[model samples]
Target chain A: MRKLGAITQRELLSLFCSPIAYIVIAGFWLVTGAITIWNADAFGPGKPATLRDIFMWTPFILTILVPAMSMRTLSEEYRSGTFETLMTAPVSDAQMVFGKYLASLIFYVIMLAGTLIYPLLMEVFGNPDWGEVLALYLGLVLLGIAFTAFSMFASSLTRDQAVAWILGAMPLMLLVLSVYSLVRRFEGWQREVVQQFNIMGRFGQFARGQVELDGVVFFLATAVLFLFLTVKVVESRRWR
Target chain B: MIEVRNLSKYFGKRCAVNGISFTVEPNTIVGFLGPNGAGKTTTIRILTGYMPPTSGTARVAGHDVVKESLAVRSVVGYLPEAVPLYPEMRVYEYLNFRGKLRGMDRPRREAAIARAVERCWLAEALTRPIGQLSRGYRQRVGLADALLHSPKVLILDEPTVGLDPTQVRETRALLRELAADHPILFSSHTLSEVEAICQRILIIHEGRIIASGTVDELKAQVGGQRRVIAELKGPQAEVTTAVQKLAGIVNVRATADGGWTRLDIAANNNAQNAVSELAAGRGWAVRELRQEVPSLEDFFVKAIVDARVRQAGAKEDRR
Candidate 1:
């Protein structure tokens, strides 16, 4: 665990030292805050502020923003040839992957946390349900974890961060699109399977404040699967 | 404290390191001398547990590199050819991070980082970011990182490649100082550096070890048949004919310049005595008679060419 932490600490140091991290954080907040304010005006003070539009826009914004934050996690190491120095150290492959994943997750969380003022503003000007707000934050955290893991995996696949960004964004876009797509031609069980696999379908329950155990498991499973794949990809570098 | 048995590495059917084997005893600095693409870096990578060999086995500090890679890595400090480092990190921060990765506690990490910085002469650069340092300082930082864990074995791949002459001399001095306790294996294409530092030298070519031994041993082996020049004030043809009959003499060539007989002899042993005796016997005035020993650079070049020629011959014979 200490070895993992060391790697994570180094990752965080590099992440913060570069200008890209600050740019991504500032860009995410500016876009998300603008969208939330416009949606707040549409909701108006007469209606109960449900933070629905903020949560609604989160998945799409995160789909792009998360990739920007994670594209350099492993790709920059490979590009700079520091991967050799790092891998040759006493740390194991699993520790390196997990440490980098944790660092990206923490950065994502920081950016996600920046949007909390929107919900707080709702509470001040209008009556807001605390339960729904908590669930929305939890779902956003889960979504961030999933995106961070997948982007890290994409970063491991190539040495080019731009290529990694594209690789990470394409799958997330398809995931969100598939959730709301109308599949009228599919049979009953097939349609059910497709809908159940949708990220928004699981995340939708959290937005509604239902707090379903299955949805929590689905998000965690997706994050874990992608993280595991990232480890395997890093280990395969020896073979290459 | 390092051993390899028939190790080989292939990158998609192209063999980067062929079946090469050698051992490094403790407290000795062994120089790996090779040309470009001679598998020096590849072998170091495998020994450091950065990559696994395609065949055979390697042991460092008595731990199998493939089976107990973490154990091998713990005992080995590696400085790669490119001097891989994070540009954003301060020198001390980088060393401390590496120490932690090697499982050193907080106090131990601090002590190790301090010692490494002192040893690598990086005290002034400790607070500066690595990317802003000069090339020589960056190389020193790499050495400092490799030394941070206080590892038993040091594998340095072309550590002095891009440094200036003074830096190269200082690095050689540092290696000599470190080799009193640690077994060091460093690769270099620079023959003079290897000669100045290493107690034992392994000359590699085409992913194979062409020659291995002490400096004099390699000179006597690959540099067979020594050369001696003799200039005398006598008849050129007569002196040449007379020197050809001397014992231990293989061949003699005579040239007359400025009314002096200059004879160049290829002989098995010190033909100096025989030439002098002949000059005294003939009662002729001698100008110069000196034996020339081939330099390590000459021996290295010859050995590599000889290995390539033999390899080509073997390939042709197989056909």
Candidate 2:
């Protein structure tokens, strides 16, 4: 546990020491804030403005931003040869993987914190459902966690951060790709399976203020599953 | 302190470390000598628990490398071939981070870091970012991190590859001092450096240990046929024939240089006495007669050539 904390702290220090973390976080807020303004202004006054624009657009924004944030988690270490020193240290494979994953998640939370202003604006200008607003934030957090896991797994696959960017974005791309024909082609429980498997589909429940256990389990399980694969991928490199 | 038995590592179809074995006793320094791609790094990786052996076992400080890897890692300090480090970290920060990973508490870690800094001569560079430091200072930082834990075994791969001559000398001296308390197994391609510091030398060829012994021991092993060069005032043909006819002489060649003839003789034993006696009997003026002994470089070359020949012979037998 102490080793994990140490690695996580070192990883966080490394991430923030460079400009990449700030660039990523600032880019996320600028994009999200701009989209919020455009969505609120472009709508007809005839339709009641809700916080829908901000909550609905977050997953898409995170799909691009999370990969950029997590690309250097493992890949940079491999390229710089520090991975050897890290692995040879007295830390377990799981500890190393978790430390890095947690650091990315912490950065994700900080970036996500910037979006709180949108929710505050929503409450100030009009009547909004507190439960619904809370659920939206939960959904965003869960989605970011799951995305962080996939990005970490992708970082484990290659030494080049650019390649990691492409690889890490693949899962989220496939998730978005499912909306077209991929979902329409399925039927019955298979259709339900695909729907729940879709990140946005599960998130839709939380957006509606219905925080079901099934939806929560889906997001948390996805995070755990990918984090587990990240550990396996790290261990397999030694054999290679 | 370290024992490897029949260790082998295969990468796809190529064998990187063939079944080879050696040991390092406590309070001793063993040098791993090999050409490029000779599996020195592979063997060290196995010993450090960075990579597992395909077939065999290595034990470090009484821990099986594969089974008790964490224990092995804790007890072994490894400096990889590339000197892996976090270039963005300050020297002291990196050391503290590594010490934390090794499970050292605050006071102990600070104490260890101080000792390592003083030992590695890194006091001035402690606050400097690693990326800004020169290659020599970066190497010292890597060494300091390795030595911070005071492990029982030190496995360094080409620790002095990029250092200047003076830095190399200082490192060699420090390693010799450290060996009084810790057993060290370092690999290097620099023959003279190995000869200068290591008490035991291991030469690996094609993933196998082809030669291992003390400097003089390897010299005597490969320097089987003693050689002697003599300058004499005698008939070239008669001098050559006379040297060949001398007891224990294996071969003889004579080179005439105007008023003097030089005889080169390969022999299994000292032929100096017999040659001088022959010169005295034949009334030839003997100007010089000196025995030639092979140096480490000569033995290293001869060992490599002999290994290749033996490999070729084995291949032919199989065919």
Candidate 3:
């Protein structure tokens, strides 16, 4: 618990010390607003404006913003060699991984929360489905957790932030591109395996107002899997 | 206290630290003397639980480094060669953060931070950003980080590497004071610093401890023979031939001045009477017969050279 607070405070302090949080949050909101306004059917004879449109743009924004945010999480420590201080502290690998993961997740949450202004704005203009808006925000939270964990795995790979950003972005890109193409190629179990790991495919159902247990499980499992891999990678470094 | 047994680390096929072992007692300042690429840093990292040995086991503070690592880490303070620090933070903030990492809270945390600043002499720079500080100030911050929790063991690595002379002396004084309470195992290529403070020394060469003993013992071991400079008055050939046939003489060289001879006596293996017997026989008047005192620097070079020569001989014998 103490290690958890220490890591969180240190990471938060670093985040606010520079312009990373401001730039990332602003970029997220600007891009998200532009995409939501373009996609919304507010001015046409279509469905009413809901947070669904706003949230539909979140994963797309997060796909880039998360990597930018998480690129330096562990990479900077490995590069600067302060990780020796972290490793030699009286903290378990689980604590270390979870602490760093939580800090990134909180950052994503703050960025996500800042975009709530769009939904609140839609509430006054149209009679938006509050239930659907709430569900959309729920889906956004889950997606953030999954993205944060996966990006942390990339951050653990190398000390260079550029490499970490590339590695973090690549998998999400593959997942997004994989579902549409790979799902069409296979017929049975192979297709099931391909789509199970497809983040965008699962997210598509939630955005379309469907809440499936399988989708939530997919996000949770994916988050836990990458976090476990990160912990293992960090622990293995002690021997070398 | 620390104990390492049959410790070795291999990267693929190349052994970085071959089966080397040594022990450090409590409250003693032990110097780890070695040149670059000698695996001194690797050994310190292993002891601090920042790395693990490929084989064998180590016990630090009565806890297994591999098994009870957290327990060991709780009592150990480590300063890596690079002194990892977040430059954006203020000196006081960094120390306070480090204190929290070590499990101290509130009153204890404040007290530890105060002590660390006082010990490192970082009081004036407490509110200054670490990036704005000079290299000397950065080093003091690193030391303050190590001292924050008041750990029982301190592991410092080439701490004075880039410091000026004055900073080096101040750090040396700080280490001397620190050694009275906590055991310190510091690695350095600076032989004079080691000679002045350390009660015991471990000479590392090519990932192995070639010699571990007092300064006098290592000097005698590495500087295998003692040389005597004699000023004599006589015919050089007669004096040389007389000394050549003597019992204890291993090698004799004539000095630039016609009558003097420099004798390299085989150290413990030879007796002193043999030189006197030859002098008595030749009736050469002796003026100076003083022993050359070998400094630690000379012994360090000699030890490394001797180890390489021995290794080469062993490789040849194997073939």
Candidate 4:
């Protein structure tokens, strides 16, 4: 456990010491803030007092942002040859993966926390639905968890960070955009099956203030599966 | 203590380490000497528990490297060839991180960091970021991190590769001091560096250990042949023939330069006195007569060449 904490702490220190973390966080805020202003009608007097636009656009923005955040987690270690020193330490492969994953998750949460000001601003101008807003935030956190794990798994596959980002972003874009598009093209049970795989569709339920157990399980399980794959990739070094 | 038996590693179809075996006992330093691509790094990696051997086994501190890797890793300190480090981290922060990774408590970590800093002479560079430091300082930082855990076994790959001469001398002194308590196995391609520090040398070539012994033992293995070079003011043919007739002379080659003839004589023993006697008998003026002692470099080259010749012979026999 101590080893795990050490890995996470080192990762966090590396993250904050570089300009990448701040650039990523600032980019997230700029995009979200721009979208919020473009959809100013949602916060006007006669409309519903909900953060629907912000919640709806976050998953798409995260498709790029989360991958950018995680692309260097393992890839940089490989490129710098620090992977040798790290693996030769007493920590297990699982602990290493979990430690790095935890650091990125913490950073994602911190970046998300900055958006709390939007809800505070909403409270001053008009009464917003607090329960719906909380559910949306919960849904975003779960989605971030899955996204972070998948991108970290991608990072484990290569030494080049740019390649890792593309490897992570391509599948994520397909999961969020393609499935949502395919949902409209299907009918009956076909549409239902596609909806089950659609990340945005699952997240839409939370946007409507419905906290489904299936959505929670899906996100958590996806995170675990990818994290497990990442561990396997790290272990593969011994054989290769 | 560390023991490896018939360890082998293959990357796809290419063999990186092939059936190599050696042991390092307590309170001794063994130099893993080899040219590039000679499997030194691969063998060190296996013993340090960074990777498992494809065949056979290695044990460190009585723990199996494959089955009890974590236990092995906990007791071993490794400095890789490149001295990989988190460039963004301060030297002290990096050492603290390594201590934590080794599961050291805060108080113990502090003491270990101080000891390592003092030993590696890293007091001045502790606050500087690793990337900002020079290559030599980065190497010292790596050495400091390796000593932080006070490991029972230390495996270093080319620890002095990038250091200046003074730093190299200091590192050699440091390794000797560390060897009083911990068994160390370090790899180097520089024969002189290994000759200066290591008590035992393992010479690896083409993925195999071609020769291994003490400096004198290896020199003896190449037959201890000495060469006597004589520059005499005499006829080239007479100088060559007379030197060839001398006792202990194996072969002699003469070359003419201006008004002098130089004879290079290979001998089983000292031929300096015999060559000088012949020069006096022939009324030739002796300019220079000296016997050259065989060095570790000669043994290393001979060992590699002999191995390659034997390999070629084996291939020929198969046909």
Name the runs in model 2 displaced over 4 angstroms.
A41-50, A122-128, A180-187, B225-291
Q: For candidate 4, lDDT tens digit of each residue in A1-240?
A: 899999999999998987889989999999989989999877878888888887687898899989999999999999999999999999999999999999999999999999998889989988989999999899999999999999999999999999999999999998899998778999999988888889998899898889999999999999999999999999997778
Model 1 residue A98 lDDT score: 93
* Model 1 error, position A171 (Å): 0.8
- As a whole number from 0 to 100, the lDDT of residue A105 in candidate 2 is 90
Per-residue C-alpha lDDT of model 4 across residues B84-152, encoded as one tens digit per residue: 999999999999999999999999999999999999999999999999999999999999988899999
Where does candidate 1 chain A have its weakest 10-residue lDDT segment? A178-187
In model 3, which regions exceed 4 Å deviation? A39-47, A181-198, B222-292
lDDT of 2: 0.89
lDDT of 3 at B315: 100
Model 2's interface RMSD: 0.7
Question: Model 4, residue B265: displacement in angstroms?
Answer: 11
Ranking by TM-score: 1, 4, 2, 3
Candidate 1 lDDT by residue in tens digits, B58-145? 9999999999999999999899999989999988888888888989999999988889889999989999999999999999999988
Task: Point out where model 1 deviates above 4 Å.
Answer: A183-187, B230-247, B251-263, B271-289
The per-model DockQ list reads 0.80, 0.74, 0.62, 0.71
Tell me the native contact fraction for each prediction. 0.90, 0.95, 0.81, 0.98
At residue B187, candidate 4 shows an lDDT of 98
- Model 2 TM-score relative to the real fold: 0.89
* Residue-pair clash count for candidate 3: 0
Clashing pairs in 3: none
